[model samples]
Target: MGGSGWRKAIRGFNLCVYSPLAAEGGGDVGPPGASYDPPAALSPPDPPALQLPTPTQSSSGLRPRVSASGSGLSKRTCAICLTTMTPGQGHAIFTAECSHSFHFHCITSCVKFGNHVCPVCRAKWKEIPFHVSSDSPRARSRVNPVNMNRRHAHMSFQHPLLHNLEPCIFNDDETLDTTFKTSGVCYNGSINTVEIKTYPEYSAIPESISTDNFTILIHLKAPLGPRNEISSKNVYVDAEDSRTHRAPVDIVTVLDVSGSMSGMKLALLKQAMGFVIQNLGPLDRLSVIAFSSTARRLFPLSRMSEFGRQEAFQAVNSLTTSGGTNITEGLRKGAKVIEERKEKNPVCSIILLSDGQDTYLLSPTLHNGQHTQPDYRSLVPSSIRDRTVHNVPVHVFGFGSDHDSISMHSISETSGGTFSFIEGEGAIQDAFAQCIGGLLSVVVQEMQVRLECLHHNVQLGCIKSGRYASWVTDGRRSGTIDAGDLYADEERDYLVSVNVPPDHHETHLLRVSCVYSDPVTKEVINPAAVELKISRPELVGSQTMSIEVDRQRNRLQAAEAMAEARASAEHGELSEAVRLLEDCRKRIFESEAAKSGDQLCASLDAELKEMQARMVDRQHYEAMGRAYVLSGLSSHLCQRATTRGDSTNSGSFTQTYQTPSMVDMLQRSQTFSPATRQSNSKMRHTLSFPARPKPR
Candidate 1:
């Protein structure tokens, strides 16, 4: 108040107190002990709002920002309301320090009477009136984006569209598929990256089913908020088991009985074959073909009855190693036996075991069709691949370094089979055990899986990880993935990214569909759908979660980087390769799906440390590089996308290219030759283990 105004106000107060009419208009001096009441003039009206200067800097030296035009400001937001912030029609003053904007009255009120700091950032500010209730958005909700991701990290695959699920009834004998999915099986059993976490409470498994043919797992991960550049949403999945099946297999063993298969190698081969024989079911059929200078059917295809097995055992015992490897003749004869019985038993297979020592044979071994040389790239006839369950799985085993890996891998991949590089002598049994394990656990055939998202606002693409059989997408949110067979405990994992278009919803629906043919039932199970859920805009908990998933992704990035680096280094772009590996390190750092920075870095460093000019060493390094990349893939997928030696023409560096990520390589590698009539003489060259990979 001004001095004159103050005197007038004081005189007025004096007059009111002394006057008899006041207290009733109290007399101030006379009424010593009496209580006095002030006049109406004593009560002042509301004061004018004192607007303060705009804040230039905060306690932390963060400049406060004001939006004059306020383009992005929404009017609906008000700090005084103490509710969630929404954007729409509002004047706002955003403090750049905290990135929180509030109404003009909103902030001044808190500064004037309440705290001297920003509500969101907790930064100290000069005096201002900001009366905010404690019930306002708490520290957790108002925290920055990174902290948000850490809080809501739990995964959920909500109720799948519950369309047609018959109340599944189960007996005590039925169990969940656990073995193949349990440990580091997805990462060569010795990965130290992402931690595997399963939210069983968030999962829904159909229990009490009378019979379980196969299963489909779904993982729908997304940030709880708008996606940022550093992290992308991903999905991890695995399914099916191997411990439940009575399906009979019609198997033909094609052995490379060349001179190379002498001594202990021959003994191990015999023992491996014997193990398979011993494990055969009564209804299963087996045909043994021993090939050396020529192919001989040791025993024609026959059911494994006691007498039939005894006779087959005798025939196998009488066989002896001899001349050059006529792999074509063996597969040709084996194919005939398998093709005839395919109609009865869909699971027909041809196992080719070779030492690859006959690679230099000038005379090409001939059989059913054409006199083709013993090149490993010889394609198996379509007649053999078709007409059987999925395709006649032409499993090939490469014993000794001399084995034709190119041909062996070709046969296995062409017919969706497996190729095992049996290192060391007498390791044929290990290869055999790997092959037989799958053959025995076979259940459903022609299995195909698809992941379909129903929302139009979001799209998921660049799916990596799972690539065992094949993966085909429909140019949008739906994908058809190959899941060859339902084994006793074998699993397949898929990692896919989410694409957020404008107008994304708070949640999304993910559909996992599996179609397969039950071997025993002889019935086609088409379109078995499983449902999953995705959280909208990951806020906190998810950002730091599932370290194991991150490791898997890191492995993939490192693998791709290694492949590219080797390609560059081989072409004398050593620095380029180094840069690529460095890029891989960054990718590993930013990868939200998998994170194994230390392992990948250490591995690459070790490989570079061993850089010598030895051709064999280089080749091994290149192959190891490819394997390291593949190591990130699901076990089944890595096996399917196994490297086919070196790919580029400029130099020898192994580069693995699956159709999903490397379509050009797929087109180039997939060679098709016209089926010409065979001159009753030729060689169709043929080829897993759950083996632990030794770090290079």
Candidate 2:
């Protein structure tokens, strides 16, 4: 049948199947028969008795297995296979730079499969020419074919083929089935086995793995996914080396003193401030600003060494909440303080504590002159409206649910600072401590990731950042180059992840470059010409894992859009509501394409499509209703104007007046109307008015 015929048949099947009872029976006929009587009891059968298997003792009366060495005892387990091993076995086991390790045989098998290193450690080994050495231990230990197969069966019986044999030896149990097996061996000769029905415990290596006698695994898991192996040994030692420079920072603390910020909220803010002050080193300088309708500097900026502890404590304790919230004023004053201190201090930052909203500040006015009335309640001046223009950065900490997170995020984004949301008062100290610790360890002054795509045809999307700019690419047939700046002699590293179209044939190359200012010489340094090549895709099954991730992301997007539509409806934004709903429908459709097996996705696709059609119809009617109202209002306004002119006996009366319909249409089409032209003329005339009369 054709596609249309199949659809019709499916719809007909759905309609016929109304209820389970109706579908099960096609009309009743006769009454049910009587229940059958119990059959006469036959001679009672002999009771089946439980029989236990006789235990057979081995000739030696003990299992023959190698015991773990005393020094080999450890809690380290293979992360991949999750098996516990004795320290000796673990020590004998070789690990690559990537921290992956395995038994010698297992490593050999992995290498034979075009994997050049330990599957778990991901260590790359030098490719040496193959030559048979008579004295080689591996050659001497090679077993005959029969013995090799027997060993393989024994190993398979003791432990599943999936388990890694690096740190533990397996022993076979004749009583248990092939599926049931042991999982771990301890240094004290203790063994643990798990049944097939039980959940497997993943091996977690608590201690750092050693890098020796193994190869690193550099191949990532999948296209644009996380690298399969990273050498733990390659990570920088001496954690202190991560910091490049040490400069004293000048900090300004802006506290909210609104009525709402009383009691626990205010007390916690003070406690957190005290913790920060105590943690500061002698070189740092600090200032305090408290705000509520207006901002007041309670203390001037003072060096950590010279500041009196009594005075600082008094200033924090004396703070009280009153009046309305004026966050804009507080921020402006705090910025000024930072600027004044910038000439003396090399580093300056502002730490703002509040709920993340702008209730204290008025919404910005549009520049269009249609409305000439000015709202003097706005606290943010036109000069410093943008936070990016400021020299100092602002870090925000939100307390309680009442805080506006979007405004806080915007403040952080503009000032190139970090924004953190605190769920409760108890978490205030920890959050403040973490922020202050990060500030003390600040290494790179200005770090940024720059991507230079080799494939010009590919389009780049927006790069997002919290504390630093991290670049990720999302497109087909693209190569990415990530570069960043660092502080002088500051050893810094960034993880650059990029997305590219899955290629199955040709190799793709990504070029990277780095530029930074030298810390000692204070001169700019540039390093370029770093390139990486990605191999072609390897087809796995019917669906690529990337497709699954894409589908999941689409589902999340749909859910978010649905939530936003519901919120917009509550806020009386009908247009925005309808738009969000439409976006949700599109996302659902796109998700269908990524699902495995077209037949399985068919039913869900049909349901989603039907829902979308219904929503579109409803939106259409709603839009028409809105248009009708606008048109009626416009006609009424014009009629009123005409009537007024006629009553005045003006012969030159024209039927033209501003209405909601005209305004909406003009906004939609981005066109100017005759009314707007007249409004502009009036605005120019008003601006040209003579100077205000001098006061007597």
Candidate 1 residue-wise lDDT, 1-696, digit = tens? 111010001111011000001111222211233222221111111111111111122344321122233222233333222222444534334452445555443343233321245443345555443333433442113211111122233312111111012112211111112222342112111111111112211122222211111122233211111111001101111222112233566788988878777644564465456545544544567778778777665545666533334334434433445688767767776676655442455466888888754434334667788776564444465566564434687777666556655566566766767665554443444345445545644555666666777666445555564435445466666876666664433334556555433222243445666666656566666543555543433232323445444444455555565556656756766556667766666555566442344453344333333332222244554433323322222123443322221222111111221222122212211111000011112311100001122222
lDDT of prediction 2: 0.36
Q: What is each predicted model's overall lDDT from 0 to 1? A: 0.42, 0.36
In terms of lDDT, model 1 sits at 0.42
Shift in Å, residue 326, candidate 2 = 1.4
Model 2 spans > 4 angstroms off:
1-246, 306-310, 342-346, 355-360, 363-391, 404-406, 455-505, 517-529, 536-696
Candidate 2, residue 607: CA error in Å? 28
lDDT of 2 by residue, 1-696 (tens): 111010000010011000001101211111122111111100000111111111222455222121133111122432211233346643234455554443333333223222243322223567511332434454445231111222223332111112112112111101211121121100010011110110001111112221111111111110010010010111111332222233445788888878788655665465456545544543466777888877776555655431222224335544566677677888877766654442444456788887534555545455675534333323333323453434365667656556654455456545555455554454555455444543443323332334444533323343322134354544523323222222112122222233344344432334444443322233444434344443343432243233333433443344355445545644566567567656655555656444454331332233233323323444532322222222222222111111110112221111222222222222221111111112212321010111222232
